[model samples]
Target: MKRGDIIELIEDTTFYKKGKKAYFIGRSNFNPNKIEIVWVGEEQAYKDGDIDEFPARLFKQVEHGDR
Candidate 1:
């Protein structure tokens, strides 16, 4: 979906494990089919600028107020 949407991993993919939640940043610059996301975590290991790109098919949009 569009940028700023929240998404959750539905399948265990190489980049992320199942159930991981992330913020949808945008599409990959190199590939339109790929999506960029910033995963949510309690640890500070994930820097503010850290972003990951994964296949769009692996994630599903999470609605607001969703658990």
Candidate 2:
């Protein structure tokens, strides 16, 4: 997905539950191979700087009809 797109976590349980939504913030500075994202919605206790990075494979572009 492109930057600023609404992406969903497909298989991440460490920071967010599967199917959770986030804003794509592009590649990580620490590791270009990973994509950074800003968390959206509840469950903030696990958040770090409101930003986190993970592999693109763990996320999917949210479709218009998908919730």
Candidate 3:
């Protein structure tokens, strides 16, 4: 996906470790089912913990802004 694609997290629990869980980071340069992004900013947070990054596979591109 490009820089502005809205996405949601998919269930990629298998890829992550036991304690670490994948989360939905913001948009970045990515390829479908191959390349994904993980947000690494200090402000990043998921649930009650700090989520630095997540796999691009977790996200599904949202196409609402096009219309």
Number of the top-ranking candidate, with lDDT as the measure: 1
What's the lDDT of the predicted structure labeled candidate 2? 0.74
* Top TM-score model: 1
Q: RMSDs, each prediction?
A: 3.6, 4.9, 7.7
What lDDT tens digits, residue by residue, belong to model 2 across residues 1-67? Answer: 6766788888858657899987787788888779987766633623545567788788888844223
lDDT of 1 by residue, 1-67 (tens): 7766788999997656899998787899999899988787622534646678898998898855333
Candidate 2 stretches greater than 4 Å from native: 42-49, 63-67
TM-score of each predicted structure versus truth? 0.75, 0.68, 0.33
Off by over 4 Å in 3: 12-52, 64-67
Model 1 per-residue lDDT at 6: 80
Clashing pairs in 1: none
lDDT per residue, candidate 3, 8-63, as tens digits?
Answer: 55553655433332223444345334433343232244334643344455556654
Off by over 4 Å in 1: 42-47, 64-67
State residue 45's C-alpha deviation in candidate 3, in Å: 9.1
